[model samples]
Target chain A: MYCVHTTALSHRFSASQQVLKEIELAVPTGSIYGFLGPNGAGKTTTLRLLLGLIKKQQGEILLFDQPLHLHRLQLLRQTGSMIEVPSLYGHLTAKENLLIWQKLYQCPKPHIAEALQIVGLADTGNKRVRQFSLGMKQRLSIATAILHQPALLILDEPTNGLDPYGIIEMRDLLKTLNTQHGITIVISSHLLAEIEKLVTHTGIISAGRIVFQGTLNELVSRQQSESQMILQTANNTEAAQIVKTFVSDVVINAQHISMPLLSKEKIAALHRALVQHKIDVYEMNAIKKELETIFMELINQTKHD
Target chain B: MTNSFTNCLSAEWIKKRRSFSSWLVVVGACFIPLILTIMFLVYPKQILDLHHSGQFWRILQLRSWETMSIILLPMGIVLAVSLITQIEFKNNMWKQLHTAPVPFSSIYFSKLVLILLMLAQLFVLFNIATYVSVWIPALLNRDVPFPLYAINGTDVLKENGAYFIASLPLISLQFAISLQFKNFLVPIGAGLVLVVGGIIAHSWKYVYMLPPAYTALHFGEASGSTKHTDHNLTLWALGYFVVFVIIGYLLYVNRKEKG
Candidate 1:
């Protein structure tokens, strides 16, 4: 079952600025869905709509197969969310804060310890949240979200403003929550590489639109279709003529030949043809593109469209 | 549903521990009584005069409520309600609160109930402190006789009930304003300016037109043609309280983006 499903969900802050267009998102159960976008890409807006924080302007939001407007409280009871910077009362201690939420959630007391321990805040005694470092506060925020052991957890920019170690800890915590505890997660981030490893599914949003949504492998396959390969050989002049027969967009440079990435079998076939023609194959390397480049390319492609 | 409301109220109660409104109630209640005790100590003639006059309760009422009914109590309500409502905005907790598994009405009424309870508690404590103010003077000075007149429990209850009822409109008005504004000063500053205006206009022929004037008008400390009108001011205050609360609830619940 899909944990979250939105059909043609659109929102506009005002008549002039439509922050979210007609968007559809389906996050599978028990999967870490990374909502990838840049700043002002409508990721937070979508998450807020899913959590019923903002009133829905148009379209429908279904959480766990229940309409959000009809079953908001019921769905929210099962779904935990941290939108943007988690709002925490700085004056209260972590335990005191948890106790307040425990009363709200009406969960058993032991769950408080379980959540604290899950977030690595079990030992943070009596220190007011105002005294906590940013990392500690972030973790405590997560603990608040997880206190009732929700079936689905939605976090917006969970790793923003964190050190490397803190980011790693957050990633590991989310991973444990997903795999070990069997919870579904939908996490939003501006950087693709930030959550690329932890996310099993990714939805790349650009300019308030979903540019791509699929598994990580499908995303890589998309990048591979547009990827470039470089060829080094003894005779570049002849290799260009031979490479032109195999791939259309062949560019011959000084001492090397460049062409669109081919399938493994095609590359092998090209190697055989080049060797049979007496053009010694020296080396082959596919040009590596940073994940950020792929992210930008997706966004720019949307703009072009 | 009742359990959810209780939980909401419990959460609100926990939040007040860090709010200044928690202490403002106590301090506001004791302030006048503290000064009265000191006054009776420094100048013993006032209590002695009251003892000779035989109407100690009436004199105490005038002295105790002279500034309170028009100024401090109304302004205290404004600040206390403002502080209580602004806690969520100041700490950015409204977004979290709005996302909780409860209805908007639950959050709205839970806060209103807490503020009303605090106001009621303040009145109860102030009433106790008013009696203590006289006791402290009696304990300190042997010459100053303790109030010997039979304490008319009904009269005291009626007077306090009147004052509390009179303050309702002010409380509801401030709550409505606090719920709408995110800035701390907007509600309190508006309340401060309005209290001053209410005090200045408390004697106006049409004082009933102003909601803030209800508290002062209900006191009727000065004997005038207005004393007859004071009887109906609490009724009007209750009416205004209901009206303002409805408006506040509508504004709060209909808000597009609550957080």
Candidate 2:
């Protein structure tokens, strides 16, 4: 089932400043979809539009096959969100805030204590939120969003301002919600490592457009290996001139010279040529791309385009 | 529909009751009449008449609803104004309520109703002060009217209940002013200015535009005009109330959740 869907959803601040260009995105039911983008790339704006926190300029947003804004209350009853900042009242204790919100939503009363335990905030329930550390505040925020047992949880930078242990705890909570409770999660973050752990699906947005959207494996498979030989030499300048005689698209850097080899036979011939040229080789290993590096590389490619 | 309306109201009440601002309003609302009564009871006769040379006994005698509607009514207005506008200016609680499943009218009307209740409490305190003042004089074997001169229960209630009825629009005018502002000071400051401005406008004949002070001033003049067509004043107060309620509603409904 399509748990979340947007069709040609376009929102512009004004005629001059377009925040979200025409874009279609989908996150299937029970899938943990990670939204990756740079700051000011309209990630939060898109989340707001999705949750009906703001008006959509054009197109439609649907949650569980219902229009978000038209049935916002019904939609919101089953969907929880923490838009930009966790805006729980600072003066109210964690339990007091939960009690007031529970009265507002009239959610099942028995689950409030359980929800607090889920986020590991049950012990701090009576302490005022203002006294909470940043990590505790973030945990309490998650507890609030999911207290009603929403099927879909939209969190924007849920791990922001968290220490390492707090981030780990948050990650575990997200995974548990998705895997055990069947809660679909849409999380937006700039850190690839953060998303790489939990997201089964990924959407990379740049300049208010989705540059890439697919499963992680599909993205990995799309990366083609460059037929390039990296050479380490005492003198890269001489080595580059010699490699230029045999190959094209030569790339030179401080300690290494790289150029595309015509074939496997040419790689052996180049090795012989480099050794014959009296250039000492420290290392000559092929580069394997990680997701973080690949993410930056793809983002840079889009920037140039 | 009534159930839902009351449910929303109760929710708003529960949320705001725990808020510090509501505590401030409650304390401030009760304090005004308490302070005024204490001043009347203890202070030397001359201190009560700071602006005039009236006898202290007369000043204490006049501390009824009529006196409060003239001098201390501004305190009620200030309290109402802050209670309404400060909800928006101080915190994110407005955003929380706005995004809830409740109807916009419920939220708006509940707040309006709460402000009116606060004003009602002030009115009741003034009544109590008046009762005690009159009771003390009678106990001392002095000349005072029997059955303490309560403004709403006395001359005003007998005259077709025009005094309480007329004050409806007066309260409505301040409600509008409070809704229009996001800053807590704007409504209080503006209400004070209108109160002073209304007194000045009374001499200009076109004082209909100012209603906070002038709307309830009809008691001073005899109600002998048979037709009783104070259309201009009624229109001014009602028109301000209607225009403001609409503007406030539209501003609230159209506001983005982020704001």
Candidate 3:
């Protein structure tokens, strides 16, 4: 079953400027779905629409098989959301803040200690929130969201101001929350590298539209442009010509001539021909794929579309 | 609804207790009455005949409570307004309340009650100050005759109690205004201006609704006369309150969440 589903969701800021146009989104149950987009690409807007924070100009949203607008309050009880900066009273302590949230939610079990512990703020309960660091504030926010152990957690840029250690800790906490507690997470962020490691599935958005939505493996496999390869040889021009027969797109600008291979067998045949031609091959290797590159490619494709 | 209301009340109280503004309000509440008492003693107002104990008590009733309301009462209102509304505006606290499994009425009303409680605190402190200024000097064998007047066993309680009750409509109106503008200075400044304006407007008989200043103009009148004006008091205040509250709630319900 889909945890959150949005269809033809359209919203406009004023009568003239359109924010989101015919945006469709779906998140399957028990999947850590990463909503990736650059700044102002409508990631947060989409999340807000799904959660019913703002009224949609057009379309329908369903969460847990119920219409979001009709069942917002009921649906909110089963979902936890941390959007933008965590809003907390600076005067109150961490425990006090959590207690306020507990009262608001009226959760049967307060989970004050456990939630604090999850965020590693258990020892700092008595200290006022004003004294806490930015990373600590983000963690406390996470704790507030999951205090009731909701089935789905929606976090928008949860690791914004964290140092390396803080980022690692947040990553580990999210992993534990997903793996141990079996809570589905829908996180939206611009950090491709961070999302690449944590999310099981991703939806890349640009200009208020979903450019790509699939698993990371599928993302890497769908690159029909070329498998960027670097062949090191003494007779670079000769090897480039030989590779051109096996690979359709070949470029020989320098010593390292790059080509797109149709298959491994074709590359092997090219290698045999190179050896027979006495073209001393120094190195041949495929470039390692990175999500950043994939993201740029997808965004470029969307811009063209 | 009841549970959520209580929870929201407790949450607001907790926030208010820890707030610097709350402390400032309590300090201001205490300071305003104390300063007025000192000014009266040093300047020596012949506004009322202090020779008679009854007249002396009336002076305290008329002067201290009235003076405090001019600036201090409105200051208290501004404090309550700022403390309640600024939290949501400055941070994303509204989001927490927005998504919570509670009705909007609970969140809105709790803050309203807290503002009322703050006003109540100010009035209580004013009464205590009246007792000290009037009764304490009389006990110390000062020339003043019965500094604190006891009118048939109940003195300030009977007189000021009516005015306090009349001020409830003002409390609701000020709270509505405070919620409308999250800024502390705006409500505080506006309230101070209104109090001053109300005093100036009192000479004109048509100026009916401005309770704090008008109540000051006719401080110690017969029950029948006070009762006649009570209609003016209740109608105008309630009218302002209903309009303010309805407008405030509509604005609240229609407001969109900010990041």
Which candidate tops TM-score?
1
Estimate, for each residue in A165-249, the C-alpha lDDT of model 1 and write its tens digit. Answer: 9999999999999999899999999998899989999999999999989898888877787789999999999888899888889
Model 1: residue B104 alpha-carbon error in angstroms? 0.6
Error of 1 at B130 (Å): 1.7
> Docking category for candidate 2?
acceptable
Return the clash pairs for model 1, or none: none
In candidate 2, what are the lDDT values of residues B30-121, reduced to their tens digit?
A: 45455654564465342324224333333343433344455455555656555655655564456445455566777777776765565555
> Candidate 1 or 2, higher TM-score?
1
**DockQ each:** 0.74, 0.28, 0.52
Question: B127-198, model 3: which lDDT tens digit per residue?
Answer: 676566654444544554554335433665665555655565556666666666655678667766776787
Greater-DockQ candidate between 2 and 3: 3
Off by over 4 Å in 3: A108-110, A223-226, A232-258, A261-273, A276-279, B36-52, B55-59, B132-161, B181-193, B209-231
Clashing pairs in 3: B134-B147, B134-B148, B135-B148
Off by over 4 Å in 2: A220-284, B1-4, B18-21, B43-62, B75-80, B83-85, B125-196, B199-202, B214-240, B256-258
For model 2, what fraction of the real interface contacts is kept? 0.29
